[model samples]
Target chain A: MASSEEFNLDEYILHHLTDSQEWHLPFLPTIHLPEWLSLHGVMLLLSSFFLTLLFGILYKKEQRVPKGLTNLLESFIIFVRDDISIKYLGKEDGRKMAPLFCNFFFFILMLNIMGLIPLFSTATSNINITAGLAIITLTFMIFGAIYKNGIKGFFKAFIPSGVPAPVLILLIPIEIAGLFIKAFALTIRLFANMLAGHIVIISLLGLIIIIGKVALPAIFLAVGIYILEVLVAFLQAYIFTLLSAMFIGQMLHPDH
Target chain B: MTAATFATIGAGLVTVGAGIGIGLIAGRAMDGISRQPEATNKIQTAMIIAAALIEGVAFFCAVICFMALGK
Candidate 1:
């Protein structure tokens, strides 16, 4: 039997906050597995696989006038392509990136919504996962810059043309840092939004224990927060995808 | 006051500041849209982007508060 002394609110909260399981490398046990390979790894893998399977099914069973999940998925894909990718990245590049952007948006949406399910953790809530996603966007940005302007021209565009030598020197580092900061901000934005919602919901529910018998109100409040979190899940996914497209667009046309 | 107390206050201020920032952003966006009704879509898109950026900074401070509490 468990002892009463083992019951600690802080520990309980901390346990709730942390990932349920983790694993390290076989040879180097001290080094934790990368985010994509940890327990959140399963969630990530499932989300990606589910997205692929959904798309494949939708494609194979193309309707004369789409219905059900096919119709819903088509709208989301078209929205991402039109409002997010094309609006930010323009028609030429946007068309090229439409599939990738849709993948990111749906994958993240799946992960965020999964948090609402009992016993499932949010993969995007982890900084490591968000950072890994941001790194993918960063790679796209760099590739876009190189593709648009050529390697030599890409570096040259950073100086902003016709600046004093001293100002140019100062501007160079800032521009480079700005590129990374955009990705860093993206990582933090998605991670914080997801993590904060879970924390708030948990904390609100925890208040029932803290308040000691005034539990009725607390449960209602927690329910309210849970509903709000469902909305946040969709909103954050959309925001992250939109911002990624915007950042990549900036890199593609730095002169603008 | 303890460091955690100070962190709590700091975190509260961060939330307050972000709330104001987002409010101002939405208020201005509404004003812009009202003035130029045709630009409602543009204003709303810009507003959402701005609010997300501000919320990101607030979350950074909230994380700091968590670190303090954990300590």
Candidate 2:
């Protein structure tokens, strides 16, 4: 880390945004971790740890009527079951997939909220993590469709039934591309949203370092964005979970 | 112009496209809410989903433009 007098805005912002094996604190020694242990990996592990602890603590409370944390968590699960999965997916199947949807929502929500903490980096901001999650959704989409309608039906899905023969060639390619693009878009959506939020916060904070005391008012703007980031964290998690369920539901009930 | 210049312009253009889409969604959602008043929850959910999908494409292009700047 450089002294404030020799501050570099680009390097500072990029440093805070990108993942690395080393953790650097301003005016402190840089702590280097093992090659396999990266910063984003650490954040991911921390979030997962917290998630498990939360669920573990809640698992034992056997009140017939849910209250406190149990009540709140139950409400969120019900929302996912009723509003997301059940709304897009059928009743039986949506209930079956509720646990998976719950996992996706809370895991992502944990990562997003944890990232806002001062010492933590955002794992979702990494393209690889988001891509991995998107790939799971894509796999479920393709496989769910296959399971529902068999292998022939999956292929038949690309070609609308009773369509003219010549149009098949053009339509098939477009349909296939559409499937992949949707998955790709899912990947970018989470990654870009988290990354962009962090970038804006860091950039605004950096103004104080790059410039002088004249930039003090920028802190309030940064705080304003920070509050918005809190909302976005929840929103992005909900959107990701909702869209994933929607994609799988579309495959299960393909009209065209 | 250099690649960075084009990259910046491309990112700006992506914002323009997505901005209009989200604006339209917001406007219609507002209109629908005002007209029906009872369907606000459904309308708001639909609006967010549609806006998020459109923003996904915008961010995809923006990510490419950003990578170009690194080149």
lDDT digits (tens) for residues A149-195 of candidate 1: 89987787677777889898799999989889889989988988888
Task: Please list the residue runs of candidate 1 whose C-alpha ends up more than 4 Å from where it truly belongs after superposition.
Answer: A1-6, A22-37, A58-61
Best model per lDDT: 2
Return the lDDT, model 2, position A57: 80
Candidate topping TM-score:
2
Q: Output the worst ten-in-a-row residue range by lDDT, candidate 2 chain A.
A: A22-31
Question: DockQ values for all predictions?
Answer: 0.81, 0.91
Which digits, one per residue and each the tens of the lDDT, describe model 2 over residues A178-212? 89988989999999999999999989988887786
Off by over 4 Å in 2: A4-6, A24-30, A59-61
Tens-place lDDT digits, model 1, residues B1-71:
89889888988899899999999999999889989999988889899999999998888888888788667
What C-alpha lDDT, on a 0 to 100 scale, does residue A146 get in candidate 1?
Answer: 93
RMSD of each: 5.0, 1.8
User: Model 2: which docking level applies?
Assistant: high
Say what the interface RMSD of candidate 2 is: 0.5
